[model samples]
Target: MPAAFPSSDPAIPTAPLTAEMRDALRAIVGEKGLIEDEHGKRPFVTDWRGLLVGGAGAVVRPGSTEEVAKVVRLCHQHGIAIVPQGGNTGLMGGATPWPAHTGIVLSLGRMNRVLDVDPVGYTMTVEAGCVLQTLQETASRHDRFLPLSLGAQGSCMIGGNLSTNAGGVQVLRYGNARNLVLGLEVVLPSGEVWDGLRALKKDNTGYDLKHLFMGAEGTLGIITKAVLKLWPAPKDVCTAWLAIRDPRAALEILSEAHSASEDNVGSCELMSRAAVDMVLRHIPGTQDPLKADTPWYLLLEWSSARARQDGAEGMSEKMEQFLADQLEAGRVLDAVIAQTGNQSRNMWRIRESVAEASRAEGPGMSFDISVAISSIPEFIARGLEAALDILPTIRPYPLGHIGDGNLHFSFMGPSGMDQQTLAQYKGAITRAVNDLVTSLGGSISAEHGIGIDKLDELSHYRSKTELDIMRTIKRALDPQNIMNPGKVLRL
Candidate 1:
């Protein structure tokens, strides 16, 4: 039986969990699955960055999809809100609950399991709770690769990745998490399970509901499982680090390289000298890539399945010649091509370690924005120049998948500044940078989803027409406005 609400007060009731709700929920999931104490529920209630804090009546860990459906149905009956959580590695506070008093934290971490691997079909059926790194390893066991590589692969779950449509290093080649998904198993707000877990490469079904849920950030429904596309592991790969003169030169080089080899090119990442300095100063075992100093650097990679270099057509040698020509043409300042596998790994490590290095450097606001590939050079120059005018000491670490035009533009406060003072300037820096990005017709958020962090910015960026469409869809899907109440588009 559902708990009866107080007729007198409209605000969330302060009443404890009813006996009926507790017993019924425990019956569906064993005692081991329910987390009622503060200690046991601590991890699931907070996000990865500790930016948002939330409270929950209880944290329920369902063991199966069926159990998830049952829990949703029960919560709906009792007017209790449910916040679905996976590995809790989200940067935007999507998995974390709002400060509401009526929601329950529903964790999918216990439901992790690789359901099936179809090597012939080149697909893998996995539960939403499966860790991305483990899934990659499982695919590798079958001589295939799940190419959605990211920093949080070891801790971020596939469900959260799909929810955010996460883009990582390989996004330049494989696209975002949405691109890698074939199908999904979703539990709707009404407790109905929509199972679309078919592993077909071509399925032109009506509406394509999977995509709606892909980057929805769990605003529409809770994802229970997914069918992910896989690729045959590359037989040969070459990774190299090049020192470039400027962002304009980097963009030019990327255009030239992509013209030389189409999809064979894997990743093209940009890191400014200022960004590299933070990595070297904060991250131990980090080294400069080039022997000579340059304004910026680029990390480029090539992937091929065939081991043959075609006698006269050596990929590495050809790439070397291309760089040499560019250097002679005065487009490239300097370059260091990785000759061995260890060297390649070491070079990539520096790129991956930029975020941690920034934190150690100081407190600052982070912006993951995208602009036209051709317009990035101007955007960076203009944005950095404007921000520096406000605080001349502000150091901008503008780096990321420049091949795709997505840049992680970060601001580090002046030297020896206290955390309190740095915190005060976050909004001014964010607004200034965002305004510049918007003026250039760039997306405010390229990869990260709009959780609570960017709700206001989303409104400013989206026009009246687009905002109306999003609101209509939200009202139609969640009429009661209970599913992730304050997310993406405001309610």
Candidate 2:
């Protein structure tokens, strides 16, 4: 089970939703918009990983931004808390409401729509409930590309992506969700809509208010819509798999690839031998790219906007030459260049299936951390040593975007360890790894925000001054603390 909220009010009295309030909400959202039965609310209350589960007075689905505002206003007037949720695919427990707290889930799944698309301006206006894959396909249809790609793109909604400032494979090239968004339309805690959706690339006015809600995790307000930036589709692309000797060799290859390709490197992902083994074992029909096993592997890719690039060799040819040079130099043990688009996608499938494969293996502790690109090898070295010191049988499976220095460093327990035994060492292992990350000038939470999973870690690692500023902002925007209470900050 997940840890309880530190500031949970046990002595406080609980109040059930009144008939009048329910009737008013029903009037605003209609019959199909409300989910009050226990059976109906189960799907909304449980998290994606089934780690955190809760209860809700109701799960209210609003079809438009105006209806969402009305629901928020009604909840505000009644002193009831409102938990804004979209897709509910978050790894952390941010969108899941607490069982002890009585609140209604304000789901945005029904408001999915692409409002407008401007090919000339390279912008797309979309409702918050639009699926991320839908947005990507829409952009492709317009002869452009949405660079935000992730494993959960098929189901995760744009609202949740904006709420968490999600980072994915393309972040090393295009940046996170924050960089892709040009403006936002948020409904403040006071139930007033702030329409700041502008598609301009340069706006040197005053403070950029859209940033306040980008990674706020819905603590300040609800993100209803957004204007997203798009990019020209890449005409030429290449993918390669490299069997590296170690992390140092991986970093060296990354540097060489960037230099040789003139900064055309799109993504450089690292996977441990243990991680690859897990995927091959759990996922059927998956084969190792290399004939023999190595300590680590890199799934590297490059792309260019122009198809031919002034009659020079394509990216694939360049990558093939680069790999040939590295192999001859003994830096890379073995390498393979993808021959077709299907082959390229198959290579990525192995990388994307690691998380699920690891979970299927057993109970384990996972972390999303980042250090300086130069310190990655050192961080991994010391992290493994520390974890082994605690438990010699611990299996470390650290893999992620090596180009950006953010890795999902996870450790699976020994084969026969029970859940209780594994749970006992979760905190100590987390502290040990996090201590190493911080000591090396890194962040404990890299791409993932400080959701309920990392609340205590944030409070422990963040300084008093930083926490004070965050608290001040939270208080100023949400004085009543009714907007996604007990998230991102302790009450």
Candidate 3:
């Protein structure tokens, strides 16, 4: 194991599962619901990155909220730890257990069920384990739209999305996962269900407890169900790929885009030529939408609910005029509007495939950081300079949701450099990048929560008063520290 990941924490219970405990777990979840063999438990303990592999006593799949409560109660009674999982698709090691864990991996996969869809109210109540793509499709069938979307949506569950407070491309318009949720039902550390699953637009109840579990990353409680807010389905839409002059030009174009697009901008993604090429190299059948000499590129999208008429001007016409003006003004070097659905899909495929391509290419590090929208260009420029100053050979492949100011600052290892060699420079590079971010008043973590990967980073950057409040809440809810111990906080 890496030195950063320790097998045990003093506050967390590490009692091994004995025969009686195993029997009790099996009895609660039944034989079909339990996986005791190593082969069966491997995937649950392994993180999405395939690094940070941990250990679990057994894997438990509960079919309903009641069953989940019982399993949690049983574990609580025995003073055993519990790691709640939705899809096991998290980039951070939030769902993975510790190597010394004697706890059960409680997966909510079988509890996936769309409880209700209220089109009139623009709300959908669903079990947490429902796949994000499935929920999108369900909402689409009702002529409503679920705005939460990402590269992992095909496999990632809604519960994990909410737990991480995921930010996707649509966040430029609709906002993050937490913004889309109206209420949530969570199972506390004590196995008590806190039912806040109401479809109300206005609820000023005490504390607004649902917000606590949404971004807690399973450290406070397990999100079992949620009432999701929806939007009207988009009709006329336009997607254009532009090779911009630079990051500053990209921001200027985006600033003018809102008024040009009539405030219908859906997404504005900033991509470097290196990141685009990396995606095309690894993701099969993905074709480059446009090729230009500029290093910076922008994928701009606009959508409106009103359908295009026979001859009336629509999103495409407006976007075409905007691009022409930008090109004349020197902000855009070259551009191409996706003329077909396949072309538009190709553009999205390149953007979304960046993550999968990075994984396949091997031995790389990425930081999901954010700053003020205006500070993004300056941050990126200085951020890259600081990193290259440390190691010039470190290949930079930066990309981002420029409209929202979240950048996935990433880099692959220098050619021919092995994992061990790259690991040596990680500490220095991470410190440099994070230090720059802190100095600029930017966040170290943007959409991804402070899971195992950023536990220490959070402590280092956050004020003592903030951390003390968080620790107090964690201890109050889980005095035993049995809820995902040794993952988020040192305690």
Off by over 4 Å in 1: 1-16, 309-312
Model 2 Cα lDDT, one tens digit per residue, 360-445 = 88778789999999999999989999999998998889999999999899888898886668877887888999999999989998
Worst 10 contiguous positions by lDDT, candidate 1: 1-10
* lDDT, each prediction: 0.81, 0.87, 0.90
- The CA-based lDDT of model 3 is what? 0.90
Q: How does model 1 score by TM-score?
A: 0.93
In candidate 3, stretches whose alpha carbon ends up further than 4 angstroms from where it belongs are 1-11
In model 2, which regions exceed 4 Å deviation?
Answer: 1-15, 309-311
* Tens-digit per-residue lDDT, 1-491, candidate 1: 11111112222323346778888888988899888888987787766665567678788899999999999888767767777877887767777766554567888888899999999989999999999999999999998989998777888899989989999899888899999999999999778899998887788767888998988888789999999999988777777788887889888888888766545888999988888888889988877777667768889897776665557565687678888988997878878788887788788888888767876776666788999999999998898888887888877888999988899988787888766677667667778889999889999999988876777788888899999988888778767655665667666
Rank by lDDT, highest first. Answer: 3, 2, 1
Residue-wise C-alpha lDDT for candidate 3, range 36-70, written one tens digit per residue: 99999999999887777888999989888888888
Report the number of the highest-TM-score candidate: 3
Instruction: Tell me the TM-score of each prediction against the true structure.
Output: 0.93, 0.96, 0.98
